[model samples]
Target chain A: MSDVATRLDVLKTYKLYVGGKFPRSESGRVYEVTDAKGEWLANAPLGTRKDTRDAVLAARAAVKGWAGTTAYNRGQVLYRVAEMLQGRREQFAAEVAVSEGIGPKKAAALVDAAIDRWVWYAGWTDKVAQIAGGANPVAGPYFNLSTPEPTGVVGIVAPQAGYGHSLLGLVSVIAPAIATGNTVVVAAAADAPLPALSLGEVLATSDVPGGVVNIISGRTADIAPTLASHQDVNALDLTGAIASDGPGAAPALEAAAADTLKRVVRPELDPFAQDWTNAPGTDRLLSFLETKTVWHPMGI
Target chain B: MSTVAANAPGVAGSGLQDVAASEASLRRFLHGLPGVDQVGLEARAATLGTRSIKTTAKAYAIDLAISMIDLTTLEGADTVGKVRALCAKGRTPDPTDPTTPRVAAICVYPDMVATAKDALRGTDIQVASVATAFPAGRAALPVKLADTADAVAAGADEIDMVIDRGAFLSGRYLDVFNEIVAVKEACKRPDGTSAHLKVIFETGELQTYDNVRRVSWLAMLAGADFIKTSTGKVAVNATPPVTLLMLEAVRDFRAQTGVQVGVKPAGGIKTTKDAMKYLVMVNETLGDDWLTPHWFRFGASSLLNDLLMQRQKLTTGRYSGPDYVTVD
Candidate 1:
C-alpha cells in the first residue's frame, strides 16, 4: 500500500489552497478512486479536517467578490460557461460514460441537456428578480419595495450515482444559485468524480475564479458533514442527499445548518411528470435567496 | 337623447284620427284572437327495400299554409332534381295500401314556386315559399312586403318573413310588431284564401336566452304563425340550450293565451341521433302534443340519411353500409 501510495504521489500535482490556491493535502495522504466498474483511475488527495477548515475560510473570504457583481454581469459569466460546456460536451460525455456505466449516446444526450440547463438559467438571472419582485402600495408615508437577493455561499450535496444526471442536477442548482449573486461549494458526485473534476478544469480555464465554486470529491458521509456544519456556509442545498431513513435528509441538513442560521434547501426529487417541453422556469435562483426589505420615509 | 314618456299612450283620442285608430284597434283585437299553432303533420319520407314508406300518418301538416306555391324541383337542374326525387318518393304508394299519409308540402324558394305549384297540382300537398330576404331580414320593409306579395301572387301558399334584428336591437319594438302585422295583412290567400304567415325570428342573431324568450313573446303578440331559429347562416344557430329556452317560451305563451306556437330549428344538425336527441328533448319538455308536425319541424339538409341509418340499425343486428340506403 505504501509503494502504491508512493507511485500515486509521483503523479500528484500538489498545490496549496490558502487564499483560494490549491495545495497538497495538509495531511499528505492520497487515496485511489475507481469507477463503478472497479477500474483504477486518478488518485485524489484524501481531504482532512484542516484542509476542510481552509476550504471554508476560502469560501468565506471569496463571497463578497462573487456576490457583489451586478446580476447582468453575472448572467453574462454564467452564459460563458454554457458556451464553454458546448465546446467541451464530448469530453464531458465520455467522462460521464466511464463514471456511470452509461453508453456514449445516452451520456451525450445528458451532457447536452446539462449544457442547455446552464443556458436556460443564464437567461433567468436578470429577469427572475423583476418578475418575482414588485413594488408595493403602502397606506403610510413610506416608499415600499421588495426584491430577491442571493443567500450567499451555498453548500450542495450532488447526486452520487448518476454521473451525467448529477452533473446536470448540480449545474441546475449551482447556476440558479450564483446567477442571482451567490457563491457555492458543491460536494462533487460521490460515485462519479472525474467528470466533475473535468468541470473544475473548465471553471479553472473559464472566467470563474478559483473559490467561486469549490468542488471536493470524497466519501459523502465524510465531506458533506463538514459543508453542512460549516459556520461560514450561508445556505445548503441537500437536493442530492440519499435519504432512505424515512421522510428526507433536508430537515436534518436544515437542523445542522441552523447552527449558523443557514438557509437550507430540503432534499427533493422531481415528480418527473413533465419533460423539458412542459417544464417552466428555473428553480436555481429560488434555492439561493434572501428577501431583504428596505424602507425610506416619504415627504408629508 | 330624448327619452319618451313612460306608459303614455300614442294619439289615443285625437278627433281626426279616431276613426283610423278605432279601425286599427278593432283589426288588432280580431287578429290577436288566439289560433291553434298546429300546421298539419308531415310524415318524414324514408325508403325501405323495394317498397317505399308512403305514410306513417294521415296528411303531413306544415306550419306554413304552403297551398298556392308551385313545386319546382322537377327541373333539369341537379340540386332541384335531387329535391324532385325526394318529392317523388312520396308518390309511390303500395298497391294494397290506400291510407298513406300525403306529402304535406314542397317548401321552395319563390322562383321555384311556380314549378312546384305545377308539379303538385290536384294533390293535397301545399307548396311553401321562403320570402322577405328569408335568411337575413336586412332588406327594406317596403321591398320585403313587395317580395312577399309577389311570391304570394305567384302562388306561394305561405309567406315566411324574417324580423329585422337591426330594428329589434335598437329597441324599435313597436316597429317590428307593426311590420309583421302589416305583412300578414298583405298575405291574402291569392284565390281569396287566407295565406298563412310564418314569422322567422332568426333566433341565432339574438345573443341571450332572455332575448330569445322576449322575442318569442313579441313575435307571437305581433301575429306570427311560427318562430324559427336562424337562416342557418351563423355558427350558433341551433343549440340545445337555445332550443330549450324557445320551447319553454312557446309553452308558457300557450298556457297564458291558449295559442300554441311552432318552433323550427335550422342548421348544422347532421345526424339521426342528433335529431332523435332533439326529439327527445322536445318531447320531454313540451309533451307528446309537441311531437306532431304542427308543433315541430327540423330544417336540415342531411337528417334523412341518419334517420334511415338508425332505423336500419334497429331492424338489423349489425350495421350495413351507407351506400345501400336510398339517397335523394
Candidate 2:
C-alpha cells in the first residue's frame, strides 16, 4: 500500500432536517447511536419536544405551497426523489447493511425496494384524485362531486421494530403522505437513523421544496406526542409508534391526537409482525386526506 | 398641556428651539455631551437581553407589549379597506378573546391617516401618521411642513417625522435642528391642542453608537415629544444596543431638562421574548416613569400576531399557530 499517512475519512455528522436546512437539535443534545451489533457508529441528534414543535411549524408553513402545486408537477418532483436515491443507492445500502445487521447483497435489495416504493407512491400522486374521489349519487337534481385534499401537515414515526426495515420501513411511511400533497415531519427509526437522515440530503438535493418534508431523529416519545396534540398539525401517522416509548404508546398518541381532532393512522395489529417488503397500497395516501365535496347546479 | 413635551415647546407650547441659539452653540452643546462607551453599551444591552423572563412575567409582558404597540401599515399599496381592517384588528387584536388589550395607535402613511382615523373613531386608540417625507426625509421644508399639516388636519393624533440624515451627517446640525423645530410647530391644530411629535432617527443610516446617542439628544432638545429608532423601512432597523442607548439618552435628557420623551424601536422586533427584552431594558434604564403606552411603543405589524400567539399559549394549555391569528 502506498503510504500517504493513511488518508483519513470524513465521518458525516447527522443533523435534523427542518425547513430545508440542516440544524443540530435545538437542545444541543446527542445520543449514542450504535450499529446492529451494538458497536459505536455515530451520535444522532437527540431531538426534543421543541424540535417537534419546530418541525411542525416548518411543515405547516410548507402546506399551502406544496398542496397548491399541480398534482402532475408533484408526481414529477416525487419521482425525482427516487432518481436521486437511485444514484446514491450504494451509499444507502452500506448504511442499511450496518444499521440492520444484514449482508451487502440483502441491504442492496432492500435499498432497491425502497427506491421502488418511492416510485410506486410517485405514480399515485396524480391518480389518487380520480380513484378516491368521484361523483356521488343523490336524490336532488345537482351534480355533486367529491375531491380529495391533503390533511395539511402529517407527523410520522417510522417503524422501529419491523424486522429492522430501517430504510424500507422509513421510506414506505414517508413517501405516501408526501405524495398526496401533504407535508410531513417524520421521526426516523431511533435505533437506526443514519439511512433516514441521509435521505434528507437526497431530498434537499432533489426538487422537493424546503420544509415540505422535515426529518427529525431521536426518541419517538420525545417528538411524536407533541405532533399528536399540536393544534397546527392536522394528522398523525403512528405506523412505527409501538416501540417508541414501549407498550400502549400508539393508543396514548391517538388519545392526544383526538384533542385537536387530528386524523390518526394507527399502528399495525402486531407491529413486530409487520414487514415493509410487502406490496404497497393507496391506504397510506388515503389515510392522510380529506374528501372535499362540491355541489354545482346542473341544467342542460 | 399636561405633558412633559409641554416644557420643550413641541406640543401646544412656544418655541424651545432657543436652546440651540446658533449653529455653533447647538454643535457645542451636542458634542459637549458625554462620549459613548461603544463596547460597554453593547455588552450591557446584550447582558440585559439575556435575562430570563418567564411564566407570569411573560404573560404580563405580552399584554404590556400589546398595549404599547403602534400597529403600523405604511406600504404604498395600502387601501382604504386594508386600513379599515388594520384599525379593526388594532381595536380588537384577538377577536376570539375580548380581554386582549388594544394597541397604542394605528400608524399609516399620511395619505391614509383620514381613513385610519375614521375607522378608529369611538375608540381611544390614537391614529399616528408618518410625515415629513417619512422613511426618507429628502423633501424641501415647505413640502415636509405641508405633509405634517395635511396629516394633522386629517385627525392624526401623533406625527412621526424623520430627521434629514444627510444634513445631520454633513455637520449641519442646525439645519436638522431647524427642520425638527418647524415640524413640531406644524403639529399644531387650530384648537390650540397639538398632536405629539415623534422624531425618527433611522439609526441604521447613522453609522455608529455615538451618532445614535447624539441624535437621541438632538431630537429631544429640538422639542421632540418622542424619539423613535427607525421607520421599519431600512435594512437594519432596531437592535438592542441602539434601543438601550436611546433609552439612556431619554433618561439623561429628562434628568437635565425635566422634559421626558417617549421611545419607539420599530422593525425586526417580532417575538414576545424580544419585546420583553426591550421592556426589561426600559425598566432597568428609564425606570417606571417611561413604561406606560404614552412613553414607549413598538412600531411593528407582525410582532402583534406573535405576541397574540404567545398570549394565547399562556391562556390555553397548548401552543398556538399563525392560522389562529389574523393575516397581518
lDDT string for model 1 (A1-300, tens) is 455654444553423333345666677876666776898866666665456556665666677887787778877888888889888988888877777677989778878888888888888878988876767788888887888887777777775533344466567666777778777777766566666666766666667766787766655666666677665677888766675543235555566677667777765464222133223365657767777766768995
Question: How accurate locally, in lDDT, is each candidate?
Answer: 0.62, 0.89
Candidate number with greatest DockQ: 2
Model 2: docking quality category = medium
Q: What is the lDDT of residue B99 in candidate 2?
A: 97
After superposing candidate 2, which stretches have Cα over 4 Å from the reference?
Answer: A1-10, A134-146, A243-248, A293-300, B1-19, B32-44, B111-115, B118-122
Clashes of 1: 25
TM-score (0 to 1) of chain B for each candidate: 0.70, 0.95
Instruction: List DockQ, one per candidate, in order.
Output: 0.01, 0.57
TM (chain A) per model: 0.84, 0.96
Task: Compute the lDDT for candidate 1.
Answer: 0.62
The model with the greatest TM-score is: 2
Q: How big an interface RMSD has model 1?
A: 37.4
What lDDT does candidate 1 reach at residue B1?
A: 6
